[model samples]
Target: MIRAYAAHEPGGKLEPFEYEPGSLGDEEVDIKVEYCGICHSDLSMLKNDWGMTQYPFVPGHEVVGVVEAVGSKVKNLQIGQKVGLGWYSRSCMTCEFCMSGNHNLCQDAEGTIVGRYGGFAEKVRAHQGWVIPLPEGVNPVTAGPLFCGGITVFNPIVQFNIKPTDQVGVIGIGGLGHMALGFLRAWGCEITAFSTSPDKEAEAKALGATHFVNSRDPEALKALTNSFDVILSTVNADLDWPTYIKLLRPQGRLHLVGVIPNPLSVPIFPMILGQKSVSASPLGSPTTIAQMLNFAGRHHLEPIVEFFPLEQVNEALERLQSNKARYRIILKMDH
Candidate 1:
């Protein structure tokens, strides 16, 4: 029996739980989770916000661990290898998207926590293809978010073919936005940060933002009209969509990685007149994820994180719910 923390009901406290995972599948690997990052998606699943939560739910997807066991058919990974798993646990290998190396977009993809138990346990199982090897020089403790939040923001850069000379803007200087700033800077782009917190100006700059625009100030936002080559929105809150659209230069793009619950009402006139575009994407595929990890390793880029023991998961959840996490929170396995 593998020990884990699970909530039997939505909005209930997570407590001790155990489960017996039967025989592993041929393509599956058992990972001994060392550090699991608590993401907002975990909170959403706990509350059944997306209406897809299954009770006795173990809510963790951002995981860094060592491969403890591999099924007979598993290749390309070996026992004792350190790897990270993200929101996805499996994708149908025969799908068109999977064949094209866009496995993250597979329609039949299996979420790590959507229905099945997730990495909040002492050990988790996933298809070998969904488990990415961590590059040398990346810290496993802080690398967990890269699997989820990091890849969410990084995927668009590759998909859009964003240029190194491009001027990029990142909204919300929190978990995802902070990582976007670091990656955009390391990619050699000029970075601008759109934040409501004036106190975060310096911190955002330290995180690789070359400019900080207080989104709370209409004048500050108005002055940046048609300035960005790409603006990456990483905030879940509702934003002034038209204003953001106005800030895009001709042929510029506004990409969303954040999960904004409401339908965005954008001004079509501006997009049409300027030939601007709007797009969004989920986490990257295994290949793109590997590229992100390699880039992070080469640049020594990492997420700013707070640590909590796995047993204190409820407390960590509360912190995340209260919006008190500095950037990201990692649950360290105490067992």
Candidate 2:
């Protein structure tokens, strides 16, 4: 039996719950969750924002844990290895996308919290493929966000082949955006952080932004027209789409990693004229995740995190819901 905290209804407080998981699959591994990160997606699911959450939901996908059990066929992991699991729990290994190493694009990919109990528990189970081993020099406590937020931003840098010499812009210096600044800086790009909050300029620079732009200021945005090679937007809020498009250089791209609810109202004429592109992507494949972890380890990059005991999950949720967390929030399990 796995003991966990669960919500019986939307916006309900998480309470103690327990259930016996059936026998593990031949390819599954059971993780003894040590730390789990609370993402905005968790809150959205808690409120049924996307309308797919099930009751008694245990919301945690950014998981850093020890492998407590492994199925017989699991060859790459041992019972005591440290690992992390992200938004995805598994993907159909035989899909064309999966076969081609784009498992995150697999149509049959399984979300950790979509319809199953997640890592906000004593133990969580997932197929071996999604259980990423933590590399040396990476701090597990602050590593949780890398699996989701970090990878979300990093995947685009790889997909678009962002050049080290390119000028990059990151919009919204929050969870995902903050990390993007760091990754883009390490990738050798000249980074500009665009944020409505001018007060965050110093902190954004400290996080690897070479310049800061007040996104709320029209003149400030207009000054950078046709200057950026790539702009990565990490805010979920809709903004002046046409203005951002105009800021891109010819053949440049404006990429989104945030979950913006509304359909984008982009001006096609400017994009067609400049050959610029607008695109978005989910998290990366496991192989890409491994590469990200290694890069993070080498660079000593980690999220700015606040820790809360697992027992005080409600309070932590409130902190995130209130948008008061400095950055990421991690729940430390008292085993």
Give one digit per residue, the lDDT tens place, for model 1 in 1-335.
99999999989999989999999999999999999999999999999999999989999999999999999999999999999999999999999999999999999999999889998999999999999999998999899999999999999999999999999999999989999999999999999999999999999999999999899999999999989999999999999899999999999999998999899899898899999999889999999999999999999999999999999999999999999999999999986
Clashing pairs in 1: none
Please provide, for model 2 over 184-291, each residue's C-alpha lDDT reduced to its tens digit, 9 standing for 90 to 100. 999999999999999999999999999999999999999999999999999999999899999999999999988888999998999999999999999999999999
What's the CA RMSD for each of the models? 0.7, 0.7
What lDDT would each prediction earn against the true structure?
0.95, 0.95
Q: How many clashing pairs in candidate 1?
A: 0
TM match of model 2 to true structure: 0.99
